[model samples]
Each structure stands twice: as structure tokens, then as C-alpha cells.
Target chain A: MAVDEGLKIELGKQGVFVTTIEELYNWGRRSSIWPMQFGLACCAIEMIATTMARYDLARFGAEVFRPSPRQADLMIISGTVTKKMAPQVVRLYNQMAEPRYVIAMGACAISGGPFKQGYNVLKGIDRYIPVDVHIPGCPPRPEALLQAFMTLQKKIDGQPLTGPDRPRFLDAEAQGEFPVPVQGEHDLEPTSNPGVWTVPVVIR
Target chain B: MASSPYFSLAVLFVAALGFGLTPLGLAWLWGRVFSPAKPNAVKNAIYECGLESRGDAWMQFRSAYYLYAIIFLIFDVEAVFLLPFAVAFTGLGAAACVAMLVFVLMLIEGLAWAWAKGVLTWA
Candidate 1:
């Protein structure tokens, strides 16, 4: 159960911390969101800049970009998700430990950007893996990436530890592995992950 | 038992173990209650780096690399001994000189044997 905000504030003023298990759990999870070190294209440079001194993503406790999916808590899709690279990306996402989050950090990653018409581009990484945040830009500035990160943290903080609305990692029955697409004779065997995404039917 | 000196040592040992184990036990319990493990083929795969791993890690290396091992030992051991011998050369007695000569000759003999075996010739 959530503690009353006013009561919590009063307790804090009196030097006593009042927090529920959910609050403490969410606090810990939101604080240390280590992004995977994998990068695809130009937006990766902006992602790198965000971690550097000027933008200082370290302030949010997300400076540690783990090279392995096993250690990473977040995956920043920082560029165009080409069809050629989509399989590997989905495989990496599948391999990541539970409570994983994805940030589609550019126009390219979110919706293929200028390469949308190109046959080589995957259109969006969310086609294969669920994206937690979508930052709209050809290549989003470091500040935009930081904003998306804070938005993700807020999303994490609001997630209930228990109940039907609890995040996928907390849900035992939720699908764990997103299928990795294979290169077919023409294109990827499967265009999108049906579990996470479905082709939107435009109503005329 | 309270008067025994070993009792305090036993207490400290138990405290030390508790200090290390308490958090571990708590974490395990927390996982069991809250985070249900979600293991699948992709997540449990042997290779972690995106692409599926191709070959066996148990593949054999070329046996011809042993020649380089012998060559390395000859130079490495000679350098190690020769540096100290050279540094203390003027202060050494004739017996020490003879001993050093024998050591150098032994290494030289190994090199000569390697040369006779054509081990130095790069294929």
C-alpha cells in the first residue's frame, strides 16, 4: 500500500523516512538504469555525448553503458534499424535480463526516418522489440535523449510492483523471448513481432 | 562456556558468516517472492554477443607453436640471468664466472639443438 504523500512529507521533515516496499523497489530500479553499449549509426554519437561530461547522463545514474545484454537494464535504439541488423538486435533484446527497457532514440530507430521507403531499413525497432520511449528527431540532441531517459525513469517509478498492471518482467505469464527474424529470400521472414506489435488498420 | 575464550571467537565467526550470508539470503527470498524467473532458449544461449556462436571452444591449436615456446624460453631465461651477471661482473669470482658460462652454454646448446631440428625455420 502507498503511504499518504502529506504524511510522508511530515515524516521526512521530522527526520523519519516513510516509504512502502513498492516505492523503495521502484526507487532502486529507476536509479541505476544501465543502458546497453550497442549502437547502430549516427544517433549513437549523440547517445555517447549524453554520457559524456557536458550532457552528464551520469547525474541520472545511467552512465554505465554495459557491453553485454546480461548486465544491461536498458537498450537505446540510437539509429536506423536496418533489416540486416534487426535479427541481432532482437536476439540481444531477448538475451537481456528481466526488467529491461528500450528507448527508440531517433527518427531512424522510431520509424526509419528518411530511409522509411528504403527496402533495407526495418522502419522501426519497435516492430521486433517493445520500445519504452520514442524521441522524435533525425538524430535527437543529447538533451532530448536525456529527456527521454527521465521519462523512462518516471515510467519505471509509476509501475506497480504487484497487481494486473505490473510490468512484463513482474508478470510470470508474459512472453519473455521476442522472436529473432531470419533473412528470407526477399526480406526478413517475419516483418514484426505480433506479441509486441500489430499492423495498424487505417480507418477510412 | 561463557568463560571459555573460544566462545568469543566462535561468536565472531558466526557474526562474520551472518554478515556475508544475510543479504544473499534476503535477495534470494525477494526474488522468489517478487520476480519470477523468465528463462527461454534465447536468454539461456551460450553465446551472448547477438549472433549465434559458430564453433566449439575446444578446438586444438597447432602443435608447431612449441618451437616458439622453446625459442622464447632460451631468450627470456638468458636475458634474466645475463642482466644480473653483467651488473655484478666486476665483483664476481672465477667460480661464479664459470657457473655463468655453464648456464649460457646450456641455453646455447638448446638453441643449437632447435636450429639442428629446423625449429627456427618459419614454414
Candidate 2:
């Protein structure tokens, strides 16, 4: 028994515990997220407001606003993305490392809000890049953002790699109305396609 | 019988250099004390306004720009020299005032030459 205990101690001294120690460290790092200090439009103001004294996002261990994308793990797509700006946003998303998560923070990001009819705005950000979570509101209240953070925490715990029904929105699928992609200038313009069915044909 | 203009300028230059270095030196010392130990790879990078840096730092600018910039700097220095003299002209008496008038005429001649060269036109 004394010899067995001595052998265990020797193995521990030889860096046998390094992997276990690193795993524990990684877990702690992932749990307390340091969001990147990035914002596109109006929703970004609300995101900043969340960090202020009133809402105090620091309580959730996510107050560190890293300016560098390489150092950050979470990206909050907080506003309407125009077609010109879409590619830049996609490039920024791709620059972030894998196991990174995104929080689509507004009705604009989730479904382009009122700008869906506009030619410049993207119908939805998800069309450009994969979204892990969607927080549906014109500009969600800070408390709603706090709730979304809790939802994301639940997602991290669940660890689902790929699935259609991963994130549960408040009004899932935008109050039963599916988002239609704006194809071009003519597509958004008022058309008299009386024969065309209202039922959306999901493009494969 | 009196101190030279060159002697007064030397004193101003030394005082200006001392004032400029004070803030720079304090910032350097403060950074050394509080900054984290820069791991070898991450520390040496040249950050170009947040974007990743690429290519050589030895960038070449157009010669047209250099010519225009030199002209601007010469005029700027002339203004700096003339402002203080203008403020003190009342006390300087006749001989010093006449010397400054000659300097102004020379500056005007230089400006006319530049204008004739078409460098004064907004490109």
C-alpha cells in the first residue's frame, strides 16, 4: 500500500496531472465569457446599456469587452445588416475561432425587422452565417438580454453540435411567419403575382 | 551690449525638449511596472489600427505629396517666426522693425514663385 501511494506521487510529479489541470482551467475560462467590444447599430447601444450600472452584466461574469476578435468568444449581432455590410460581418464572424457562439440580438438580426422589404438590408443574418441563438425583439430590453444570457448558458451545458431546434425563441419562427429572402430590387417591389401561393416553399 | 536672438532661441529649444520628454518618460516607466510579461510571439506584432499588419514597414509615398508638404512646412515656420516678432514690434524700435519688413518681402517672393509653379492650385 505504501509503495502504491509512492508510485502515484511519482506519476503526479512527472506532469501526469497537466491534462486534467488544463481541462479544469478551460472549463472555468469558457463559463465566464469575455464578449468582444463590437457593435453595428442601434441594438449595440442597448448592449452597452446592459453593461452599465443599472443592469450590471458584470454579475454574469461577461463584462470584459475585448476589442480583438481573436481574444473573444461571443459575438452579439446587434443590428440590421445591409447587403454591403453583410460580407464584412461574415468575414468578422469567420475570423473568430471555432467553438465560438453568436447571439443574434434583435428583430433586425433575427429577421431584418421592418427592413425586410428594403433592398439594402439582408432578410436575415442566419442566411449569411450560422446563428447559435436568437433573441427576438425590436431592441430587446436589458433584462431580456440577461434572460438570453441564461438561455445561452443552458445551451453551453446541453452541448448540441447540430440540430434545427436548438435555440428556443420567445415567439419561435417570428410569430409563425417564416422569413422570405429578398432576391433583388424587383423581388421587394410590390408585385401582382396573384397565382403564386402564400405558403413558403423552403429552398433546399 | 545685449543678448543675441540666437542665444534666446537656444534657451527656448532646451526648455521645449525638457517639457516634451517628461510625459513620455513617465508613461514609459508606468508601462514597464504594470504591463503583463509579453509572451514572445504576441508582443512583437505590429498592430495597424486594429487590422492585422502585412508587408514591409518601408512604405513609399508619392513625390508630389512630399513637395507640397515641404512648401507647407516652410510657410508654417515663417508664421511661427513672424507672430512673436509682430507682438514685440512696438518695443523693437526702427532698425529691428525694418529688418522684419525685409523678411516679410522675401517670404512673399517665395510664395509668388510657388504660385507660378502651379503647386498652389488644388489638385
Candidate 3:
């Protein structure tokens, strides 16, 4: 019933489709990427606008946003990740089922934006979890996020599961978990630093 | 014993339930088979808006709400009793009228007592 305009004449004899196993697999995975229904700060407003009637993120088949991290495969770090919230963010990232992705949406999520020198702000979410796409803006417009989605889809299409040098998420269950940060005197630390964790016992 | 009409109803109910549950079951199966689920300590921890939860949630609640709930119950029960009286009003005799009058008077008395006690005022 439906056909591509350019390919109409080319497939006049036989409209039968053909594709390799990997292509089919990649297409299925990239199409229905369910992002987490999570937000941190102001940039979240723009993220929400992208899903509304005007932008209609559902057109690309990625409208389902799961509240639970276990259900979501895409994480959009929409705003600045504060030091106090680092542990919980890492924890959330670890819970996401593979093949999972992280999109550092907006400059705040990418590198703390204008709050780069703030005492409470984490430099970037990448300090803990690996990022897939980085969209740079103090608070990127809805169009920018849509562009990020396109870029991420393209990235997903390139990954193959059969090769030796395959991406980490190629084997759905092979993703390494990021260490949850621990509270330190000045800021949260990923490692069990003796300077932070070990209490100096008072001796007589 | 099973009959044709009841059997038809059972079949319809079963079809409805199946329609509702099939999609949910398939989704769960697909997620279980295709999605990887490996949880650790931090990943499994309760979410509290991206921060660790503070002190115990339970604390002593204010007693003023108790009076409000009790007042609501009195009026709610009064409406339940009044329903039968209103339904049988045209068929009732003088004796029933007297009894209904007494019942309304008692309710009015209770309301007056609560009003006198300043229970109606917001503290």
C-alpha cells in the first residue's frame, strides 16, 4: 500500500524488501528507544516541549518515557548534575537495562554550563557514566533535542553485535555499571579515598 | 448448574480479560527475553528525586483533623438514615411523621452542640 517516492520505478517488477539480520536488528532497537521520565532542572522544560503536539517526538517512535530506570533504555541528562545528586544519578544509570544510552542534553548536563565554577555542581555526568550524544546549549531548543534524537538513531544504526571490536552494549547484558559516588568533606568521590572515608581514630 | 445465558456471559468476560492481559503479558515477555536486567545496591535503592532520603517519615500528626473527620462521619451517616424516610414520605402515617421529626431534631441538636463547642471554627 505504501512506497518510497524515489524507489517506486526501481521496484516496479518486485516490491519485495531485502535486508541483512544486523540491519533489521539495529532498526528495531533504534526505533522505539524509551527515554526515562526524569528531569533535573530548567532544561527539562525544553525536553518536555519537544514531546508536545507541535514537535511530536512520537513521530520518530520514541514517545514512551518510563518512570522506572529498569524500563528505560535512554537517559537524557537534561540539566546540571549537582554533587549531592551524583550518587543517585549514577545509581539510576546503573539500573537502566541495556542496550542503554545517555544523552547529555544542554550545556549544563554536558559540562555544568554557567555553573561550571559552582561548588555544588558536578563538572559533567560523564565523570560517572559514559555519554552517547552531547547537545550543547545553556538550554537547547526543542529542535536541538530532535536533532540529538536523529544523531543517536544514526549512532545506533552503526553498531554491530557480531564483531570483536563491538560496542559495549552490543551484547545487551555486557554494560559495565558506574560506581555510585560517596559523600566526602568537600564533594562526592567515586573511590573509597582514605582521606574522605576513613575516620582517624582518636588515640590517648 | 451451568446454563446457556450464563455460559455466554462467562465467555464474554473471559474474552474481555484476555484482550486486556494479552498485550501486558507480551510486553513483559519481550522485556524479560530481550532486555538485560542486572541490579546492584545503588541501582536498586529507592528514588527520592535524585537524593538520599532524610530522617524517618512518621511523626505525630495534629489532632485538629480528628474533629473534622468525626464531624464528616456524623453528617454522612445522617444522610444514609434520611434516604429511607424521604423515599417512604407519601405513604407514611402520623406516627411515622412523629418518629421522623424526632430523628431530625436529634441531628439538629447534635449540630447545635458542636456549633456551641466551637468545633465548626477553623483553629
Give me the candidate number with maximum DockQ. 1
| lDDT computed for candidate 3 | 0.81
- Give the per-residue lDDT digits (tens) of candidate 2, residues B1-123: 237868878889989998999979975774464222322222233451224467987999777787676577558978998899989977998999889889877877777888888888999
Backbone clash total for model 2 is: 0
lDDT tens readout by residue for model 3, B86-112:
999999999999998998788788788
Compose the digit string of candidate 1's lDDT tens values, residues B3-86.
Answer: 998999999999999999999998899899999998999999989999998889999999989888889989997899899999
Model 2 lDDT per residue over A48-159, tens place: 9999999999987889988866677788888898775665565555455334568889999977898888877766677655677789888988887888887777666554
Candidate 2: clashing pairs of residues? none
* Top candidate, metric lDDT: 1
lDDT of 1 by residue, A1-204 (tens): 667899989999999998888988889989999999999999999999999999999999999999999999999998988999999999999999989999998999988999999999998998899999999998899999999989999999999988999999989999888999999998997988899899999999
The candidates' DockQ values read 0.70, 0.03, 0.26
Model 2 spans > 4 angstroms off: A1-27, A30-32, A52-61, A157-204, B1-60, B74-112
Interface RMSD of 2: 15.7
Please give the range of 10 consecutive residues that has the lowest summed lDDT in model 2 chain B.
B34-43
> Which regions in candidate 3 have their CA more than 4 angstroms from the true location?
A1-13, A171-175, A191-204, B1-37, B44-68, B71-123
List of clashing residue pairs for candidate 1: none
Better model by DockQ: candidate 2 vs candidate 3: 3
How far off is each candidate at the interface, as Cα RMSD in Å?
Answer: 0.6, 15.7, 3.2
Pitting candidate 1 against candidate 3, the one with the higher TM-score is 1
